[model samples]
Target: MHTCAPPVETLEELLEAHPSINGNFGHLLLLQKDADDGTLSQALRPYFESAHLDARQAFHADIGIDLHPDAGDGDGPAVTYPGCLPLTTRKGLFGEVLAGLVTEGYPLVGEHEWCVPIFLFRYHEDARNYLFSLARRPERRRQTVGRLGSDFIGLLLDENGAVIRFIAGEAKWRKTLNQSAVDTVMLGDLIDDPAGGGARVRSGKGVWNDLNNDPPVPIGVRQLQRLLQEYDPDGYDAAILSLERALVVREPVPLPRTDLVIVAGNASATRDTLTCFLPFEGTPPEYTAGHDLQLVEVVLKKGEALIDAIYDSLWSENADA
Candidate 1:
């Protein structure tokens, strides 16, 4: 017999109330019911479309990386609307979730103020392909580019609007919820320690490093710093100081950084998946870096098919109309 967990009205509440196995870390288990005959997608259609467009705009505004140059030319984003292409819709959904997490103030390493959905900006190749197709660049079609860093990187701020932490997050949508799968998804993209010590390090050299460092900064971090400088000079100074201190610190002191892992899959609600799945045994050494690590597991009854069904329903409803 399947035990019925408490019903949650919103995703934010679901994540917030999720049970954490480790007292030191946060974990959430979300078991989403199948969509209600297209009603849920219908209600969320506007938000999804808006989130896609807004995420694109934010990327352009912050990093000057415009996937669709003629997006807002009144021609409608170089893609179909009300029935966005599957990949475009997927990107939008991820961005929407990130925006929701930011708005809901999910705990991170700092006092958590605000966040920008910078993930899609880095990993979205479908938009680029669409634009390339429009430009008649067929040779570049379907060419996959490697991801530079984490799936999602949010610039977390303090109450004073000062940049306090950089939250690097990874989101995986799959049908499996086993231990190997969970660990692979969580620690796969993180920088591996060179000492062969089997330690997965969060902050390190290259793109994963602190933002306020000197020249040759990563494009995304550089854009964030520029945004702070343009909007809040004082906040910019704070970010610079934080970065400088990060470089000077020899030992692991409290720093503004976090690694968030989000896994969505199919699982039994009553089963104890946390202890078996995550690597959060007594006093995990991974958390010794003074950076917060959070894991959120979103369990869906229908698993991976849930999203495909919702999209199909959305398109079918639009077609019937």
Candidate 2:
């Protein structure tokens, strides 16, 4: 299977959202855990399991880990799970997966049935190279790193089963959604003070900046096309061709694109709860990317606690059996 099922009911029950704010350039959403709902222990594990499904499978395969049903006889390879990854790596993976889940579950940019058929976790060479290192050259240190390129990608297929549009996403997770933290992501990180007179300067490169400069037909789309062709050629033949037509160097077909940005974290203590990181009344000035944009803010309480609990529970039933 390309992607595991999202826990739609679980998400609906566990989280609450403010009414979506619409603008000509994009729409903004703010979501947070619902305090009144008391069954987070039950509702959340399934939600996180769905989020990390691709990473668990992809990472295990990439690192040569194997799985067998109830094989505790010590006759097979160790079944490594992504749940055991370092805190940073685990947090990043959650952001990416949650972004895709929201993109697919909700009607964003007037599309439905958004499919994230492949996750690029296998291509996170930092983890693979470090984890797969052998005795010849012992691994220097483990790298808690994220995959390069777009963090999330989803395709919308037409009645003919050809891809009509795509959404490329930048998903980030922060400890707090304060202005400085938000600026460091949407705007560039603060550059070092050049002169003796210290001044916080931005590096002029950030998520919005990168998205503005992205090619109309993103490289992620090409990567997706190749994966589908290689893995399920007959099943995704039309999608592959449609992507190929759009990717051609000359006179390529123009495909509609949506930019998705998800910033998920705990609400900052210093900030009032009435507003969010992105502007609500109008399109964000930071987002110059002409494509339709869907901005999502996911704020949570005791986020790390929830993250740990949910991740630890993935496949626990199988492991315990």
- Lowest lDDT sum, 10 consecutive residues, model 1, at 1-10
Q: What is the TM-score of each candidate against the true structure?
A: 0.57, 0.85
Q: Give the per-residue lDDT of model 2 (tens digit) for 7-119.
A: 66666766665646364344545556554233664465555565555556666666666555564474543335565466787788778767777876666655457888876
- In order, candidate lDDTs are 0.45, 0.71
Residue-pair clash count for candidate 1: 0
Top-scoring candidate (lDDT): 2
Q: Which is the leading candidate under TM-score?
A: 2
lDDT of candidate 2 vs native?
A: 0.71
Question: Mind giving the per-residue lDDT tens digits that candidate 1 earns over 39-110?
Answer: 444454433433344334443334333344344453323233223334434533543344344323444323
